[model samples]
Target: MAEKIIIGITMGDPAGIGPEITVKALSNPAIYDRCSPVVIGDACVMEAALTIVGKENVKIHPVSNVDQCLFTPGIIDVYDMKIVDINKLEYGKVSVMAGDAAFLYVKKVIELALAGEIDGTVTNALNKEAINLAGHHFSGHTEIYAEYTGTKKYTMMLAHDNLRVVHVSTHVSLREACDRVKKGRVLEVIEIANKACLDLGIEKPKIGVAGLNPHSGENGLFGREEIDEIIPAINAAKAEGIIADGPVPPDTLFSKARGGWYDIVVAMYHDQGHIPLKVVGFIYNPMAGKWDAVSGVNITLGLPIVRASVDHGTAFDQAGLGITSELSLVNAIDYAIRLSKSERIK
Candidate 1:
């Protein structure tokens, strides 16, 4: 049998659903069959999560280092950072304490990945407002990973089953996002999207680039971005022998991509990409007053280390409720393992 991939999972905001989902996802023995998983967070938080999820069979084994992890199916080996005081943390609320703890956990995991101590890292949801309140002023996980890993050129790829999308710009104002969509940046993201598909096992990725304007500028009637920037980039990409096409109309791009017409869609901005992916991944049950499933993986491309994250946020409303679904976290772990294994083979 092949050796199991060791995945480092960062416990996100203590006040959020991070702990609950982490514990629930790890309860399945099948996870251990694929990889040796370790949680990098407060031991007390994980213990509370275990209780909340009623996973009595699973024990939280606190380890000071990764080497001490047991990698057992019924046990959750945690590299306890001991950053949060469970007594001070409140469910369904944001606090600086939780934010600081979440930041520290992510920082530690990134350090471990850089040192080759972990094959790849999987992140739970962290609260952006809380993190900023704690003084770690960054946009989100993608920025944090890029900064700590010294990665200058990186893009966020959201995947749900076969429908995948990559952003040209994320976490920026719409105006700023629009301004940032130049040929250089558009072409850069297209290349990253292609490479991301390869990492996900696509031999020759067919990429569809979304236009920034209506009707792809209708040949420069509505906007000049397509003629001046987007199309130029597509031409540049084709010249480089990449199987890319578009400045496709945004209205129809996602439908085609979802139907397998393209391996990946190069969204001009964040919402253009995220909305379609989320619509498919997020499942809500109004009658039940809860989410039935939150299933998607967010992969960071053009980084030295492999990282996959849940394509959802810190559901503070559901924290400590034990009702949150772990599907997204599970998917994230699967992506981490696939990306890590692919990296090893290359």
Candidate 2:
């Protein structure tokens, strides 16, 4: 038997589904079997969440330090920021207070992980607009982690089961994303993707690199990016003994990846990678008039500490309804534990 990994979970925007899902996920007894989880958010929000999610029996225990956590299943130990004003808090609306608190919670978790207080960190969804309104100018969690950890080369990896995709350039304009796809960055991402797969215990990982233009630039007809940049990167990766394939047609790359032809796909840009992943991970039931499931894990590769996040955003429309899926968050926690355990072994 192994010791449980300590995972710090950042509660996202209070105006969203963060608190509700945190309580819902914690109610699972199996989670405690693998990790000692703590919520870094307002205790009041969590208390109210317990009621909203109908998990009132689960107590919210506030602890100033990780050492103080009981790590018990039914008791949700929270490193309470004591921030949110429960009376003023309203679901489905963004406020500066919620935004600031969300940003601060992430900051504290990052600090703790850097200090070796926790093995890994898992974050719920936070509103980008709200955070920007609150004055923290981060693009997303990946950017925040890279800046905090002082990591120069890091990429976002989104996973839903076996179909994993890593981006060459994320959180950038379409034109900029195309411009950013040079041989150097492409090669860097390939190397990172190879290392990530290896870390995940995949032996001799098969990587499929997607092209920037249609039909891999149609032999320089549609564009010269594949001929000028992408091919050189693939050749460079192959020379280094990495089993990387493509400038596969962007249209068919995902289908082949999903068919198990490749262990991972290196996407040229954000939407190129995200659209396919989401198409597979996010499911909605029109008949039921609700989401059947939202599943995926967002991982930041090449960071000093382990970090994973739910693939979905702060669902403002479904905030207090308490009907949001915890599948993504649960998967994120599992990924964090796996990554942390692997890091520890190394």
Candidate 3:
């Protein structure tokens, strides 16, 4: 095998399942076999998770840099962010301290990836409300990565198996999000999805765009956004030699992508894309009111550094609950390794 890939994993909000998932994900021996992973957050919180998950044998090796990591099977290297108070941390409660720590970890991870300190990043879930409480005003992770890396063109790509979708505008209100949909932004998103597919080893990515309204505006009957904005963007992308087409029905486009007819589906908004990915990822057992198998990964495209995240949020209700699934976190790390390997090849 080639040299091991170094992936920096970020521990998100201490008030949530971030710590738990991070610990449980790394507990798998296969993870170490694939890549060298490091945690970039509070040691106290991770210790608590380790104890809860019954992985007392796993050791957290404190290291100063990625190069110092041992890359061993039983050791999880940690570059402590040290921005939390374990004593004051209460599970399932939103606090500014937790938010501040999460923000710092994310910031530090971005810096490390940009500086070539690590190959790529995989982040656990962080609460947006808590992040704002700490006065780090931002929409979400995609924006944070974009801002710190000075990346003007960026998009959120959510993936599960062969199904992948990228949103044009995420983390915006319904009214404004609809208004923001124009030919330029639509074309930009199409290009982003296309380029992302190429990086993922797709020779020619075929993208299908989801409509903003019912039946793609029924020829401007319900809405003209499709006729005026979406279709124009699709044409522009095709002109650039991109295999792009649609303004397809929002409800049916994903079905086509899932069938492997298209490489990815470009969603107009957040829920339109997220709902479908979750349909396959978010599997919960109602008997205990907890997810049994949480899986998927969110990759931010067009950034200076590669950043992937668990396709879930800060489960405030399941903060200390042993029920939190570590599957998503593991999938995120796997993606980070794949992305890192691709980068190295380039």
Candidate lDDT values, in order: 0.92, 0.94, 0.88
TM-scores vs. true structure, each candidate = 0.98, 0.98, 0.97
The per-prediction tally of clashing pairs is 0, 0, 0
For residues 183-276, could you state the per-residue lDDT of candidate 2 as single tens digits? 9999999999999999899999999999999899989999999999999999999999999999999999999999999999999999999999
Count residue pairs with overlapping backbones in model 1: 0
Candidate 1's TM-score? 0.98
**TM-score of model number 3:** 0.97
**Per-residue alpha-carbon lDDT of candidate 1 for residues 84-161, written as tens digits (9 for 90 to 100):** 887888997989999898998999999999998999999998998889999999999999999999999999999999
Write down the RMSD of all candidates, one decimal each: 1.0, 1.0, 1.4
- For candidate 2, give the lDDT: 0.94
Q: 274-306 in candidate 3: lDDT tens per residue?
A: 999999888988998667888889999988788
Q: Which parts of model 2 are misplaced by more than 4 Å? A: none
**What are the runs in model 1 whose C-alpha is more than 4 Å off?**
none
Please name the candidate that would achieve the greatest lDDT relative to the true structure: 2
lDDT of 3 at 154: 89
Off by over 4 Å in 3: none
